[model samples]
Target chain A: MKVKEIMTKDLTAAEPTMTVRELIELFYQSGLSSVPVVNEEGRIVGIISERDIIEGALPGYFEVLYGITDMNHLSQKLREIEHDRIEFYMTPEVIKIEEDEDDLTAADLMIRKNVKSLPVVNKDGILVGMLRRIDLLKDLL
Target chain B: MIITVTPNPAIDKIYWIEQLCLDAGELPVMRATRSYLTAGGKGINVSIFLARMGIENIAMGFIAGETGRAVERRVRDEGITTSFIWVEGETRTNVTLLERGHEQRPIQITEQGPTVPPDALKRLLIHYKRALNRARYVFLGGSLPPGVPTQFYQELTHIAHQHHVPVIVNAAGEALAHALLEKPWLVKPDTRQHTEIAGASLKTPREILAAGKEWTARGIEAVLVSHHITHDLLITCEGAWDLEARDVQFQNLLGAEDALIAGVLSATVQGASLLEAARFGMAAATASAESEELVVTDRTAIERVLPKIHIEQLL
Candidate 1:
């Protein structure tokens, strides 16, 4: 079966210019930790997740990067870039799959990329839907 | 940012039933073979169209109850930014029944929508003014719900102009008439409800051109009038042009006008000339009319239908 057969439909994407605060609200509204970011032409430019938001928002993140504990500064860090756009923090190198690709290939790519959700594109490379890891576990298993 | 204001938004439940029974006697309930639920509001339709074309825009309006929430969620899924003001009562739900053979005349039962309380209208003004700060274009579409004054569009147009933003007024009857006095950038009166626009006849090509020219002469930038779903006449500051879509098998005409508005505005924002924009818009409308969906957004399919859309400038 093709990935499109089980992939979620009517997936929403965020624009790169959206503020971190806005993206967070979107994550809350969509109940998704991450969403594909698209350019003006609707092509997938990157994918942003709670991981990126956490990394980008938290102050003293540099120290925390080296495994230093800094939970106290989390609130301060989140407010610092609340208004900053997500372009810099987003993962520009996106690993996407074609909608028509086999379900086995989709699951294999997820394992290789170590990602939970993969953006699905059409033959024209336009973002269409998203295939979640949970969907794979439910269907492929 | 482009802001689309849908004064009254609705959830459209379209059902393709097995058959239509017209007798006065009691009949068995028809079964639906297919169905679709869409976010239905003129401005919302345009917002969806713009979003699908990769243009970021804001969909603003008043919403109420769970039906309203459903409409907002559906449009948000299309990637259109929504700034809805919550009101009391349930938002309207329009039921459209389409028979297999009579696709043209779908039975429609639409409610008047939720009443906008005084506080909600005030909040809308505040939000509208704030949105105007970043707005490049504003589209005021659909009719006012109960409790909202007819001069609502006029007031919004006046404020948008104060912010130096071009406003597109797409309404009918008193709403369109009041907005006209504000000299909106363009006026595309909603013709779905009535054959006549502000007591003006659009029955013939000559009357359509005359009517379009009348609005343009009122210091408005342009006026677009549709005729018989096959042709459209556009009168702009520079000149007038006639666009005719040939050989289109119209499956549904519900959202064609809104698609035209979106197509034109999308092109206008991209720096396309008025003539070119009208041509593109008519093609989009034609593509929409030929499909069962409310609005068709496939770029390739729309472009393929472009050549069949003939346009000629009027002397």
Candidate 2:
């Protein structure tokens, strides 16, 4: 089985220019926690996830390393980044799988990258679908 | 009466979950503590916003299946007039999973809307004819469902112009690009849509101004560029104005643009000048962002922000 055989085709892609607030609205309306960020040429530029946003809103790594815990300050920080564009927080280094790639390849890629979802692109590198880890498992079952 | 059209409408389902955990080789199961189902679509949002502002408006669109019925029923319950053409397939359902607390970002899943048959499209146009006849402003919004041509909004705008009704279009991609040719009364394109139409990244107000000029040259009366709720740039044949306000922590950013549209329309209908209308639009957007409800009509909240708005007019 190939990635396209099990991947979800009907996707709601994100634009690089989408603000964090707009991304949250999309998440609330679509029930998706992560989205493939696509550029104008229909190429997948990055992947933005709920974790990425939460991390972006939270304190820096040094603060966490220093064991600074202030809930109110943390919440205030979240509000500050809410209006920032997704690209500012999105993981530009995305592990993508081709639509025609084998299910085994997708499973292997996910395991290697430790990513839950891999954007499935075509020969032109335009995203056509998204293959979740469960999708490959289901195909195996 | 203001008439808003949404060729594709859906039921927006919002789920508030405690946490989201996905395990490989296992089905992810999460419980939602709170949920909301609202009638959704770009035009529906505009109509809802207008109605909340005490403006008489009609929401016209193609709705189908049980979800469509539910959407129509819900909109009518909101005290807004509904004129929807019943189509064949079920209306799409969009899902949003929001983790508890404002800390977690939301996840959105959008389903493709039902395909509108040619007959249903014809019926919708006929309804538009009657609705446009009485409409002071016709708002053509959202993407067309499958089987509808990209030039759909262009044709609809032409019809509205023929009926002497001004049109405000909020669309993206080809729909927006095509409608610009018809010179709609106003076009509100968010950052992404503006970039798509301009085919370039617009980072500064100068780039935005140049793009606005390009669109105005095409005869569009006004180009409203909504920059992620941070700023709203309004360019007209007369002059250009960039309005900004202190960012308030938003409950939900949904319908902020619609709120802006409603504010501008409401102010304009009351015979306010273009600059005054833009101010009201900014205030209304801030009020909407201050609430979780899709559209806000808290006049007090809107008025509070009205004075804080800083408007810079570029001559």
Candidate 3:
């Protein structure tokens, strides 16, 4: 079996400029922990997980909870928060796999790096599919 | 309230063909093909099945690009309510080929998905926390995306604990192993996954049961083993129980595991006993095996198989 043999082709991805609130809503509706971050060309650029949002919002959240009480002031703060983009918090370092890689090779990379998934790209570095650990195990079975 | 997360979701393209052939310098062709793009993800599948069974849940994850938009649109089109994290990458597409007339086998092809940045992952965690504030059950399913650590599930499990929410994890390998320390409410690992996690080639049901018990003792509230060829075993805090399904005419096997999870969670949410929920899971799984499509088992089908499923206590 190869990586293409058991990877997920149809995907749901995320954009760099999406707002935090919108991202949260997307996470709720989609039931996924992390989403692939891509550019206009549909290239795999980065990834955002649930952790990033939670951690990023923590400081601002604390400010609202302990530092402010006035409704009008909180509303003004909320606006600033809403304008935040995903690019502000997204991790820049990304690890990906080519689409033609063998399944074993992909599995080996995941195991070696202790990562759960890897982005698949074509020759042009266009985002194509996702190779997940569960998919790999499913293939193993 | 229950919330499930699916980071990399797809519009599953299932193709039914008479035969599949590949020739040198000839494009691989399929015969008599049929295609459907359903909301695809372990978490989303659970949510949809649960919803069909009248279990209210919020489907949470990520959506990106055009494919992501289509998936969200289609899911909403199904009347299944969903909330997603919008990102930059286009959602993936998964293909499954069913050789109908020839040998009744399936060939599944998947793509390597888009990369998720660390910030996106962070935003996702924050979203989970927000959802956790309202949810009683949190189901973290599917695989982590690129740029996220294998311990992502483990982190979520910890956060769920902080919010006093029970977590159920359906994953494999390091992702699964690392999360066990958090003592999730449930962990459903297929037989092969169990073998890999245990680092041994298990042969007998007894060995599998023993492994389940061990995991349960280690803080996992329940360990559900989905056997490849045999009955599924449910190891709860009480004891080990084997729920066996009667042999029935089969159609497709895909999505059976997800259906089982949905059934179990649905029953549990309704305050059903572990035994009862295990029976529900078994019945749902059996029903999935009887359907050609990945639709949730109807109430009648589930009830019909309920009596046929035998549960044996292994205490």
Q: Which one wins on TM-score?
A: 1
Q: Tens digit of lDDT per residue, candidate 3, span A69-106?
A: 56675456445666688888777677888888899899
Best by lDDT: 1
Put down candidate 2 lDDT per residue, B94-143, tens digits, no spaces. Answer: 89877756522458788888887775676567557755655798988887
Q: What is the TM-score of chain A alone in each candidate?
A: 0.88, 0.88, 0.81
- The sequence of per-residue lDDT tens digits that candidate 2 reaches over residues A15-110 is 787788777765654456998887755578999987788788873645455664677876787789988989999999889988898988888889
* Model 1 misplacement above 4 A: A1-141
For the predicted complex of model 3, DockQ is: 0.03
What lDDT tens digits, residue by residue, belong to model 1 across residues B108-127? 99999988888678756765
Q: Judged by lDDT against the true structure, how good is candidate 2? A: 0.78
User: In terms of docking quality, how is candidate 2 classified?
Assistant: incorrect
What DockQ would candidate 1 receive versus the native complex? 0.04
Question: For model 3, how does the per-residue alpha-carbon lDDT over B1-315 read when each residue is reduced to its tens digit?
Answer: 688888778878887776666663467756656766687888888888876777667677777777887877676544454556666677888888877753235677776566777767876775566556567898888866666688888999999999899999988777887888798999886444346664633346787788777888787889887664438888877888888877766677678888888888888999998778878887887788778768555888888877768888888
Candidate 3, B-chain TM: 0.92
lDDT value, residue B226 of candidate 2:
72
